[model samples]
Target: MARIDTNVKSIRYPVPCDEKLTLLARKLKRTKRQLFIEMVDYFYRSKKDPADMNDEMLKSDLSRIGNRLVGFFRTQESELLVPIHGMAQELVGNTETVKDELKSIHEKQGDAEKLLRENTKHASEQIRLLTSIFDGLAKMEEMRAGFRRIMEGYIAEREALGWSTSSGKKDELVRRFRLKVDRL
Candidate 1:
């Protein structure tokens, strides 16, 4: 024979409450009325402001957090030491020095990179300036060559016309031809 749950009374709700009642009753491993009694008791206790209770709750929470942190560090310490256990003690002793040296090397490498960039910028500017100078020289050479060609052509034409190449006549011809060629 099954036991009967007697002495039940009706409970009312503004909204659907059957699901919540079933869940709470199942979780507490009790009848619906027992769960209701506990709920009512908690509701009256919670009528006090929670802000005051939170301070105490926060302290407990922090104490639990600290315990967890200590446990975490203990586990991590064992894990970290496992890999290094086989290494020679000499290397372990020098580990801090090696770390310092590596840090210094990294700092020097950064400085060297900055210096290299500065030097490269200076080199690029110098190359540009040199290129400009070379271009100017090339233009001047082209102009000089053009003037020589004009003089040579005038001499050839004058000689073909059976003209004299006397010193005084040569000077006068050069002066007149050069002035005419310069404008063009």
Candidate 2:
């Protein structure tokens, strides 16, 4: 049992003066008034009553209280410099390394993207040339069919007119007609 301080005037009652308060004071190494103020602060931070709290809500409240208790113990036991300084330096180094690696990857990706765009443009130009060649071939076939029809018609008309089939006149007539068609 520890002696209560006499100079403390702000001590609130219903302050558990039992085994719990005694254990808490020994654990915190704080006076009863200081522990009370800590408890009040914790309560203020944790109080949030749901409109319809159930057993799950009660469990959540208990978990928060347990967390506050552990935090208080950790604060009491914490060192001022060693863990904080060491962890901060380690985190800073890790972040810089990660940033550098990401920048390197981004540069590589940008180069790959540029290459892909150039390849795509080359493929599109090749496709356009192929399409134009096919269109020209189709037009040439149409012209060949039209020329064959005209030659067959002229041969039929000469046979019907009783012209000499073996004469060079037929060749001359075909040449003159072809030149006229070309001009048209």
Which candidate number would show the highest lDDT if scored against the true structure? Answer: 1
TM-score for each candidate, following the candidate numbering: 0.40, 0.47
**In order, what lDDT does every prediction score?**
0.80, 0.79
lDDT string for model 1 (49-103, tens) is 4347566656777899999999998887788765567565767768978999999
Model 2 root-mean-square deviation: 18.9
Summed backbone clashes in each candidate are: 0, 0
Show where candidate 1 strays beyond 4 Å.
1-95, 164-176, 180-184
> On residues 14-133, what C-alpha lDDT tens digit does candidate 2 reach at each position?
645556877898898998668877877865676744344664667877999999998987785576556777899999999999999999999999999999999999999999999999
Local distance difference test, candidate 1: 0.80
